[model samples]
Target: MSLARTLLDSAATTALVATMALSAPSARADEKVSIMVGGYEKQIYLPAKLTEALGYFKDEGLDVELLNEPAGVDAENEMLAGAVQGVVGFYDHCIDLQAKGKFVESIVQFSQAPGEVELVSTKHPEIKSPADFKGMSLGVTGLGSSTNFLTEYLAVKNGLKLGDFTSVPVGAGTTFIAAMQQDKIQAGMTTEPTITRLLKTGEASVLIDMRTMEGTKAALGGTYPAASLYMQTDWVEAHKDIVQKLANAFVKTQKFINTHSGAEIADKMPQDYYVGDKEGYVKALDAGKAMFTPDGIMPEGGPET
Candidate 1:
């Protein structure tokens, strides 16, 4: 071939390569979103973990990071400080933040039923109902936690006042176990699979199944409002597409979880998350599934209640 023809062919090839590169889908830097979880290895936040493990976030072109923290006030503070783009926990905290002029919004509802929380106590077996809580020292995650709110609501519903019982802020997870064992508090509110473990070990007995209580509707309306994906209103507005994509991914993950068995869900989870005990994980998953909503939409009054 002539030198001029060779040069032209080379130029055409380069141009074609450039065009293909430009046409191909690129990684969306804006799609990277950080989410804070209530606690590590808790079944309540399983949907977020499942979404990450199942590549649902990646499927939606979002790079999601899950940050596990204590709960309520701490999570809200982190989100307000911009350490996390969103939070997966009680919606009431979001409402509280909003009331404080923080301007937060819930994108999805993870748990509609109060599947995990319970007022458990081996020390007070006679305390079968909320009325018995008077004069008792109750354990709570923190002052602004759903546990605290529920405890107060339960007390009020039982014709008692907030100060009727003393509430000690026993942090969630291992800390709660320690507090219980040390008898730091008489009764406490906690979630599974910790609750499951606690019951299995006989460390505590459920005094009140908040799940069956009528006050649950008033506290969180009819929706349990256990956990959700919340973000600052401004941040959500700035990244509307990314937010929608993330919600879509969560919805997909939730559907997948609902259709599949617990063992199947465990198989997809990391060894650390699943802990090699399929049966236990399955049971936990079953419990968790009951709380999950198939659709990602936040239930009405979830934020306000």
Candidate 2:
């Protein structure tokens, strides 16, 4: 072969190889991202679940592993320890972690309203207003959770001092129910589908729908900043495209959920996740639907009153 012809052929080969390399799938394909959830199989983590079930994450070219922890700080710790790349929980907890230099950032707003955190009581039928909480024993998940904070906020708003009410940490779910049944607490804060079950069994009654409260609306523009997607700020910065893709997937799932009815969501959801009976699941789904926004914007001032 002539030298000139050979050189030309070599150049063409190199160009073709370069193009193929550029067009090849990313090397990061094998990379897996861990996502933390506060609970296992709960409706609060439905967006992430739906994203997995619908293959949205796979469509985005990501391998997402969902890890469930006992909600709150433990979940945050898993993210901090690099056990997970992200977490789904209260936006306030993200803020709190950020305040403590945990380097967490909220990627998407999941639940726009406080769907589950409610004050319920059958004994205090007369306790219709926040003011009635005075001298009441309120059940909370823990000391620094959104539950405790909101209950305290309610007390403050109602012209009652924080000391006026006692907050008993019931650890949520069946624990909250057991506490209520034992008369350990007169009022309790909890999320559905547990709340629905409690109400159905006449164990408790809804005293305040925090999702629809004026203060909550004022905070989140009629949306409660209940839960959201959170990630380590470092991870987000290092994987901007991936973070955006994840958010996009979640947003897609949110839209799909909104278009579907309660029965549809229940059908798609695993039976184990529905803590309430089927009817309770439907009620909770109907009530919780309005709390999730189609878009993933974390409203200013947090979730609505």
Candidate 3:
């Protein structure tokens, strides 16, 4: 779900939230926080769903509105516009913005790895390697997204320039599937459910897989810090108490995931989140469980890696 805009071979990914919602806690809450997740129902960002399902936010006296925005940029813009309290997105984004002289801070971590795989369209049988991507149309979530950065990184690793291949902006889930069916993109990188669906349909095959920690270390030379909860430093500074409470809730959630099965966790989430494929969802969820951190804290030097 995350690849930093810039390259860092040894960096690890943290959890991200880019959601917005309006809900009440069991008790009277003192404040309301809006969180936006870049993608909903994908394995990469399942921690947020799990957290909500377990009612950890309510337990901590927080009224959270969990909203889903497909584009991380849009979610970030929401934060910039002060429409949301926090964003669950690629941790690299904090670094990306800081480099531009704006400071964004990650408060809680969800995953330590990029929970996605690179895929090649079955129709493009002639393309057998990353080097063959030259002159091909690859798909990304958007122009400045993690997938986009990974595409550029892979091309450069394969002796091709960042612009060697074309990158088409393809949204996740059904839209992504449709793009492949229409031959709009020859290959792309995406998270579970979508990746699992394509493989099950015999439309695409795995290219580079960072869903595993070993693969992550091998591919980018370190953790890429995929999903994380972040906000502008000013927000974090002004709301330390609320931020602490939020962290406490999410930390409890991480522990909850550690003690439960993926099936159990998925069952708590909305039934439609699986899109009517419970078995597939569980299978995909199980495969990526190891990618998540059992605590809400970002490891020391993890972001700088």
lDDT leader: 3
- Candidate 1 total steric clashes: 1
Query: Over 4 Å off in model 2, which ranges?
Result: 1-28, 212-215, 218-222, 300-305
Cand. 1 TM to true fold = 0.83
Every candidate's lDDT: 0.69, 0.70, 0.78
Where's the lowest-lDDT run of ten residues in candidate 2? 13-22
Please state the error at residue 159 of candidate 2 in Å: 2.3
Residue 259 displacement (Å), model 1 = 0.8
Error of 1 at 285 (Å): 2.3
**By the TM-score metric, which is better: model 2 or model 3?**
3
Model 2, span 192-242: residue lDDT tens: 777777878886877666544353565334545677787776787788667
Q: Write the per-residue lDDT of candidate 3 for residues 1-305, one digit (tens) a residue.
A: 13343323222212222111112123445889999999987778887877888888888788899899887777888898899989988887777776776667777777878887888999998878789999999988877877787788888988998668898889788888899889999998888889888998899998889897778888888766678788787887788667766777777777777788889888798888787688998998888888877776565445655
* Candidate 3, residue 106: lDDT: 76
- Which regions of candidate 3 fall more than 4 Å away from where they truly are? 1-29
Q: Order the numbered candidates by TM-score, best leading.
A: 3, 1, 2
Provide the TM-score for each candidate, comma-separated. Answer: 0.83, 0.81, 0.89
Pitting candidate 1 against candidate 2, the one with the higher TM-score is 1
